[model samples]
Target: MDIKIIIDDKNIKTLTYDSPVLLSRVIRDSGCGFSFPCSGKGVCGKCRVRVTGCVSEADEREKKLTGENSAFRLACLTKATGDCELFLPDKNITALTDGLCSRYSHSPFGEGVGAAVDIGTTTVALYLYELENEKLLSVHSFANPQGIYGADVISRIEASLGEEKEKLRALISKGLEEGIAELCDKANINKEECKTAVVTGNAAMLSILLGEDVTGLSASPFTLADYFGKTVNINGMRTYIPRAISPFVGSDITCALISGSDIMKNEKLSLLVDIGTNGEMAIKKGDEIICCSCAAGPAFEGTGIRMGAPAREGAINRVWQERGKIKYSVIGDKAADGICGSALIDSLALFLSLKMTDETGLIKNPTVFEGQPAIEIADSGVYITQKDIRSAQLAKAAIRAGIDSLLNSCGAASEDLGRLILAGGFGSFISPENAEIIGLIPPGTAKRTVAVGNAAGMGASAILLSRQALEKSEITAKNAASLELATSDFFMKSYIDNMYFTKKD
Candidate 1:
């Protein structure tokens, strides 16, 4: 039977299935984009789809989850019995392709054109450069098509261990190829002109793309199959992927460090935090750099929240309290549909200040939003529920705890840091003061905090344009030290302690 998946009434994808299967599995297998906040656990109820054809009737659990919207079924729980048409929400993700790039002399490997790619778990960015003059031609980005399997790396890794491995590889491979074509089209150049590329990403992404065995990444010890500091063929293009620092901390951080070299020169002890699904951080103490990664989850990226979203159109990105009234700014100047990470942090700060939420992250005076106890925005339908607060709390605690662990390992404190460079898309929009207020970052470090948006992409571009940058990336990857946080008692203790919002002195 054929299942037609319609996205926002315009984009459509049809998949053929033989037996009745879970709608979530069907969607996952179809490679269609859908937000599985809880990885299709059916607990979040965020994967709501309208089915018009043969489908299983909603059970008690599904009925309870769907509430009064009986017409809609949770994709995770519902089963597709026969040919059906599924109406899905539009996933117009806003990817961060631009970053703070430092200029370097042109010393590229070859002539013509080249592409530099940052393959983030959620988004992938490609930068095209003219190798002859080292001039940037165009930039392009898109949601990682592998997201249909799951939201986090763990989910993707599990999926890659099975028959769906090739599907996963092909999706990213095709996405990058299309992005390269798009860049060439916009730049008025032939595809043949782009002969070389540098692709940087986490270990799992790199491993999957290269079609390497990833069983080592599935369990403890988390052995990395390949360090990947060499050149290989990627869909017929000669691609160079940078080396990773650790199993969790991949080449993305290596590229970020390379891009931010100018910013870390003066600081004796500088810290870089790449806030994403994995809270990857690096502490450069003297000439040595030590790195670590914590499982921060996807809460910061708006996953697992009742009314959370990425920094996209209709998403709230900033929030502030003015004269006892909560004020917010939305992306695209549109009506608020959901609150993103930066706003979520700001809201927590504001909530704490107004005594709306206590130190334990409990809503003091919660109102009803979507039939659940939530803090609703006045006039706007967007709201944040208790679960959302917990999700944010876990993510923040993990990040902060990881920072503390890294600082402690170097016999240093937050005050000892001369610079705190925040990297990644979410890091760029966050208010340092608000982050401190919510205990997402250390106190009194806001003055030193600097957000360098998408440093990894910038570094990848540097590698594409300059050989020195590429050489530096290779050296940094070889020298950087990786720390295991799971065994650290300090990390475990600090994680629990950081869960409680610190009282502002």
Candidate 2:
């Protein structure tokens, strides 16, 4: 039977999909604005959808999630019986094209026109530059097409091992091609006019992009068959890829350090933490750099939370407590549709300060707030649930534990580093004060933290502009020491220790 879902919004037409599949899969296959935080495990309850058509009754997960008698159904748990009318969060749906950094200073390497692409797990940014004039010609941004598969690298690696790997690789390649074609068109040049393309990403991402097998990455002592950099010809353009440091810390981190090499020249000890599903961090002390990767999960990017969305329009990206009243700012200055990652941190801090939530992340459910384990962020009814709190706790704990592991390995404390550099989109948008309030970043590091927007993208640009920079990336990748978290007992201990909401006095 064909499944039909109708959005209750003006000018929005009904969506028809063939089914016998879970609604969550259909929603993602349809490329809608819906999210599945648990990757459709039915544990997060974030992929809720409403139906008025023929369908099986909600399952135990749905029933428990929605309080047994609720009208909405958990999309992952509910299977279709026949054609049905479905409703979506129309006003709150976000477009992925926004929140891209198109700004760049031309540092074109080689000669002629070229392009640099950063293939992030959640997003992709591309820049077209004229090497002759050192001018940045065009820029484009889009959501990583593979996001529908899952948010983190492991899900991606699993997807890459099965028959779906080809489909997955094609998705990213097509997105990159589209972005490249658009950049060429915007600059009024032909696709072949650009002679060079520099790409950077984590090992898994780069592996899939280059059509390499990912089975080795799934086991203990993760290994990459394609750790060595390669130059391939795509659409008549020579594409250059950098070597990965390890299976987890790929070339992107190398490029990030390269982009920030000037700052590191300050001759002070510092750390570069790239916040993403794969939280990659590097500790630099007098030319010696040690790095590690943590499975921070997708929670930080607004996945896995009910009423959570990406940093799209209407997403509550900011929240604060003003004289016992809660206030927030949305992504596009519209009404609160759903909370994004930044708002998640802000709400955690606010809840802790207001005593609405305890140190263990238990909601007090004060008499004034409907006696539910939730903190309402807006009058529009979008709120953070108890599971969302746990999700944040897990994500934050992984990062904090990763930091501690790095610190412990370096035999240093938080005060030893002169600067803590926060890179990537999530880190760039987050408020340091809120970050400090929740202990995501340790003490003394907050005031010295620098948010370097799109450091990986800038690093890719640097590679395109200078052969010396490209050479440095290779050397950096080879020299970088990757800490294996599995062998470290301290990581597990610190992970459990940091799981709760903590605020140092």
Specify the highest-TM-score model's number.
Answer: 1
lDDT of model 1, residue 450? 88
Q: What is candidate 1's lDDT per residue for 368-458, written digit by digit as tens? A: 7656678986557888888789889999999999999999999998899898999989999999999998999999999989888889999
On lDDT, the leading prediction is: 1
True-structure RMSD, every candidate = 2.1, 4.2
Model 2 misses residue 296 by how many Å? 1.3
Please write out the lDDT profile of model 2 over residues 86-127, one tens digit for every residue.
666553432222122222344455578999888888778888
Model 2: lowest-lDDT 10 consecutive positions: 94-103
Q: How well does each candidate superpose onto the true structure, as a TM-score?
A: 0.95, 0.86
Tell me the spans in candidate 2 whose CA falls farther than 4 Å from its real position.
1-37, 45-110, 261-263, 366-372, 378-380, 503-505
Q: What stretches of model 1 exceed 4 Å from their correct place?
A: 8-13, 261-263, 369-372, 503-505
Model 1 Cα displacement at 320 (Å)? 0.9
